[model samples]
Target: MFNDMMHILTTQSGDILTALREHILLSLMAIVIATVIALPLAIALMNHRRAGEWVLQVAGVIQTIPSLAILGALIPLVGIGTVPAVIALVLYAIMPIFQNAYAGLTGIDPILLEAADAFGLSKRFKLFRVQLPLALPMIMSGLRIAMVMIIGTATLAALIGGGGLGTFIMLGIQTNNNAELLIGAILSAALALAFSWGIRLLSKLSVRRIGVLLVSAVVIIGGFAGYRAINQPAGTITIAGKLGGEPEILINMYKDLIQADNPKMDVQLKPNFGGTTFIFKALQGGQVDVYPEFTGTVLQSLVKVKGSISHDKQTAYKQAKTLIKQQHNLDLLEPMKYENTYGLAVRQADAKRYHLQTTSDLLRQSAQMTAGFDPDFYKLSDGYPGLKKAYGLNFKNIVQMESSLRYEALANKQIDVTDAYTTDPQLKQDHLVTLADDKHFFPPYQGAPLVNDKTLQKYPGIAKSLNKLSGKITNQDMIEMNYQVTVQHKKAAQVARTYLVKRGLIQ
Candidate 1:
């Protein structure tokens, strides 16, 4: 395991370092921007105490909004990538900076203030020369707090295509790769420590420390700017994916095919996006051109199809494709040869103890056990609701949590039963027994490429290129590839490329 970890770290050194750099730079930028905006506001509010307090209250409200919620809200307005992420960081940071700045300015020695006034010094002159200097330490403390928050919160930025160590963290969860998760967590913690140290060093108010901080900031920012300037590629088609191993492989498969066919095709993979709703919004808004989606997801969630859906994969795909084209101006291509529908699963021990062979069997024991499910499953008509109705299940509890964490929760016996995708590598790896839906509640979830109509019109080759992936991957092929990524800890891109090569789809 140590050797394997070392190999992963070495091979991913470039990505790790780049992620670290981006994390630090983003935190620094948010802190600096917050300080710049809040310092003056704090100084002004110091004179008008009541109004200042009210303004601080507003900043406090902004801080109370969950970072991810803030990110989601910003998507429609600011779009995805770095800008929205940075804006969220800044919003989270404002309260601390404002509070400390106000406190620092107001806490100045009265005698010092009286002396400055008696000297007939202008208010602005006094603030700049005396009060501001004295309050620097307190302001620096607030900046430190803000920096810490930004560093932690910035991890969520990856959800919106904003790159950072969070990229690995998100990918790790998606693929069930513990090493990648550890790397992301360890490096993020390290970055927080390093940033806190730098902030502390600068708080001493030494000229050399300040100079060092300034120079470091400049180099980091300038380096990123230069990198971006030099690496801007033309004619790139942005393909997005929800955060998961399947999406990771699918998107990479698209990139692999595109690049192999035309090295200059510039297929950009935007992984770690939020959920179906967010991705759908992004596609409709033109933030992304193409993405991998499930036919059932399109039919039920996007198209809002009423009643029990088609069980036949081909029929479902055709219906979903037609509805999506008419409604969302999107095209659903021919599906891959796999179905990744959701199903209820429990530990092997539970299965044996309850003699569970189907949803009906589990339903009999449901009253005594606590069930865990993803939030989406809880809400989806074809998910818990439909299953509960079909099997007449009534559990002791139904805890909603992150889908990625569901397997761990189940393995640890934190949840007696949880919903899982049929293609999830963890299901087999963890030895969980899936309960058959004898009542036939869930619809077929055939995987396919969902492309924007505008993109297809512009780059006809994209449809042609992506369609080549149609009917390629089988159910067993998907399971193995998912295992290779989630259990074997191989990179998704490498796994996709290997599959293509094995199938003679690419050289």
Candidate 2:
């Protein structure tokens, strides 16, 4: 494991460093904003006991909300990227800083305050010289706690394209890559501890020195942000993907393909940018120019077209393309020659014991089975709900769980069946077999390039370049690539570029 980790870090040093930098800037920015909002408010509320209590209660409630839930909720209103992520981090941060500041100020002796008053000091002068300085220890403690919390929580920012160590963590989880996961987790913990220790040292310094240090810190962070803005490529195209190894592989392929054909066209990839909703919102809000999407997802998730799609994948692709073009003004290029639809997976042992080979075969044992499904699968109209309706399956027990955990439970015999993407690498890893969808309850989920209409209009060659992938990728090809990334712990870009070069799609 150590050797594997060292190799990964050596080969992917640039990305790991970039992720660390993003994580640091994002966490620092949140802590700075939180301190700005919280410290003053904490002092102001100190004199108003009732208002302070109420405000603390509100902040506590906000802290109770799950970070993921907060991130998901903020997507529509604020869109993806640093804005929502920073906002969420700040929300989580406020309570600790505010509470500590209030406690510190209030805990100061009334005798000390009286001494300052007797000295004929102005309120502002008393605050700066006496009250604030005395309260500095507690305030620093609060800031330290907030900083540590935000640094850890900042990983979730990657889920919504906020760009942080969380990107590596999420990708690692999706691919079952332990080295990648450990690198993200260990680095986040290290960052938090370092920040807390630094804050402790700062608290020991005099107020004047602390002020000078803080000013210097602000300038450094600001300069970093400014440098990034100045150095970024002008008119660069952003290609994004949803959370999963396959999307990561596909997006890299998209990048390699476009750049191979149009060498000078600057393209940036945001692989595993987020889930369906988050990435789609970014696309709709014009944050991303293009991404690989599924025709069935276009119909079921985006277009709100209810009912079953056509039996034939080609016809389904046309239907989805037409509806999406007319309704959303987005263009979907030709689909790859593959169907990565949903399927019900079972343990290899169960398949033989129960004689289960298809959806119809499952009916014989439905009443005796306990099924676990991904939450999205359970909720989708054409997912578990539709599957139940189609096959008249009456599972003995049905439960909703995360997609990854469901597979584990199924393997452990805690669940008799679980929902799985047809091309998921875990299907091979666990030696599980998918029960054939003889009824074809789910729609054909054919992968295709979805481009923003305005972007395509501006860069007309983008459509041509992306469409080169149409009808080219086979199921076996995607499955192999996914296996390489997830099982072999190979880089997605390396696997994608290799495939493209092998097929003469790129040099």
Candidate 3:
């Protein structure tokens, strides 16, 4: 596990750094913008006295909108990426800063203001000398709280292609990989803690020398902006895709390959890992260039085909190619050997007790069993809802869970059965029994790269290199690679390189 952590740290160090930096910048920008707007509004509201309750109520209403929902709503008007994420976070951080600033300014003794007025001090002079100076500590406290909240909320930015620590967690959940999830969670928490401590220290120092501290803050903020401008490259490439499973892994694999081949390319991989429908819309709207997709997913989810096609690999590939080209103006590249098919996984002991050797056997006893599935299954047409109808198997209960939690759920006897991918290494490692699908309702899930037609025309080499990787990686290979990251603790890039060398794709 230590080795795996180190591997991930080394390989994804760039992405981790980028995520942390972007998150910090976004949070700080939000708080700063909120402060600029809120402080004056707060002062005005407090002075009017009659408007105090209304202002507080208005700020309270803004706070009530859920962060994720606000971000999602902003995507359409502002579109996906960093801008919307920043705007959403700024709006979310406003109330805390506004409320505290208002209370701090109002709570001051009226005698101080009267003295300033008696001394013939202008309104601006009184605000700068008396109101702001006295309220600095309380305002700083609010800023601190707002900063912390923004840091935590920034993790969700990955959903809209903002690219942060949330990508790892989302991918981990999709592929039922725990190591990535833990790493993502830990790194985010550590970053937040570090920022919190730094802010607290600043708050303390501010009390002693306010002038110096304010100048230092401005310099620090300016320094960060300069660093980002220097680091940011000229060109950009946006990659988008649906949430869950092996798709993200494949995208990262391709990204590494591209960068290794041509280091000068400023390839920015933007992951739009959300619901399948969400990603599909992004692709159609030209929000992304390439994403890993399965033939079966396109057939069942996109095309909305009811029944199944032949398991013949060539047949499936041809159908997928035709469908993508005709319907979406997209290209389905060479298919990989790995097939992430849905299957019923049961604990070894349970399977043995029930003599469940196949789906038919499991179906016979389905009424007495309970099952767990990834949350998406509840929504997808070809998911559990469709599977039950097609097979006529009814479980005693159905539990919606994150994919990573499904194995534990089954082992702990929380559920008797689980919907799992055929290539999951845990099925072999944990000695879980997988029942064969005899009904053939599930289509061929051969992995392939889907690209916008324009990208293929522009980067012809990309297609060539990716095709070279096709059929080279099998189901066993995928399981082992996934295990390396999730169980054995190896970095995804290292595993990919090792596999490529072993397969003679790269030297």
Candidate 4:
């Protein structure tokens, strides 16, 4: 693990530093924006107690929505990237700052104000010279809270391509690289602490102190803008992928193929895009040009196809392609040979002991056992609910968790049954057996490239470049490549390069 950390630091030092700077800029901007709005609003509402309470209540309600949900919701209105991410952070930061500012101003002793008035001070003079100084500590406390919240929440900006430490964390989860995850998490906590400490230093504010802070903020903003202006690159094609080794490898494969054939085309990969839905959203929103997707996912989730299994596999794939093109203006390229559908898995011991060979067999024992599934499975039509109704399955307990953690949870015997991808490498390593879907509950999930029509029109060679791998990868081939990463701890790029070279797809 130590060696892994060193390797990452050495190879990705520039990326790490860039992400840290972006994180700081994003969080600080949100807190500063929120403070600017909240401080003035709090001051105006100081005498209007009833109105203050109402405003705070409304801000509180906005804060109740999950941060990711708020960010996702803002995509359509403001579009993706830093603007929406900063907006979400600012919304979350408002409540704490506003509430604290109101409390501090209202709680000030009336005698102090009376004394200021007796001294023949103007209203502005009293606010700046007397009231604000006394309320400085409480206002700073609010600022501290807002700053800390912004720093933590800003990590999610990477999901919308805002770019931050969260990029490393998401990629780490997708690739199962502990060093990357730890680096992102540790840096985020450190940033929060540093920001909190900086805010704490302003417990007693003076005119000069405020002036110095304002100047510093201006300098930082100017520097950030200059950096952004100088860093813009051209001819970049953005590629995104869902969470998992397969997607990671596929995205890397696309990058290599595109650049190898068309040297002028530069590929920028955005892997571990949280989920299939988010990836699709990014493509449709023009945040990403292309990504790997499963035909079954497009048909079932996006097209909302019912009774998908009734149609032949080719028919389902063709219908999905046509509908996606007509509705979303997205094209589904020729699919690979492999089909990675969901499967119910159990430990080899449990399978042998219960003589479970099919979904029906597993159902017979489900009443006495617990099952764990990925969160997406809960929403799928042919997933848990459909299976339960089909076979009358009622597990003793049902746990919904991340797909990556399911295999480990099953191995530890924490769950008697869990959802597994047909091509998951851990299945072979842990000697887990997949129950046959005798009832044919799932649709075919052949792998393919889902590209935006605009991207194809802009770069006509993209489709031709991507279709080289069509019908190339078989089920066993995908399983072996996944094993090379998850079990052997090989890098996804290395695995992808080796396969493409061996198959003579790339030089």
RMSD of 4: 4.2
Model 2 CA deviation exceeding 4 Å by range: 1-14, 41-66, 69-79, 122-125, 175-179, 346-381, 384-402, 405-418, 431-435
Ranking by TM-score: 2, 1, 4, 3
Q: Local distance difference test, per candidate? A: 0.83, 0.87, 0.75, 0.84
Ranking according to lDDT, highest score first: 2, 4, 1, 3
lDDT by residue (tens digit), candidate 4, 379-497: 67678888778778889999998877888889999998998888888788788998877877777899999998999999989888789998898877998898876556577888999
The clash count of every prediction, one per candidate, is 0, 0, 1, 0
lDDT per residue (tens digit) for residues 178-259 in model 2: 7889999999999999999889888888877876776787788778768886998988899998877899899999998888
Q: Report the lDDT of model 2 for residue 124.
A: 88
TM-score of 4: 0.83
> For every candidate structure, what is the RMSD over all alpha carbons to the true structure, in angstroms?
4.2, 3.5, 4.6, 4.2
Candidate 1 stretches with Cα past 4 Å from truth are 1-11, 120-125, 171-180, 206-231, 306-308, 344-381, 388-419, 431-439
lDDT of 1 by residue, 1-507 (tens): 567567769877887898887787788778876766887799888989899989989998888888877887888887787778888998989899889989999999999999999999998789878887888888888988888889989998888888899988887776656678888888888888888898887777653456466668667766876788599686668999888777989999998887777887777888777678777777887778888999988987899675667877777888899889988889998788888888888999889988998888886789999999999899977678878887789999989998778899999999999998888888778888878777767888889999889888988877777778888887668878888876766788999999989988889
> Model 2 — which ten-residue stretch has the worst lDDT?
304-313
What's the C-alpha lDDT at position 298 in model 1? 92
Give model 1's clash tally.
0
Would you list the clashing residue pairs of candidate 3?
A: 4-489
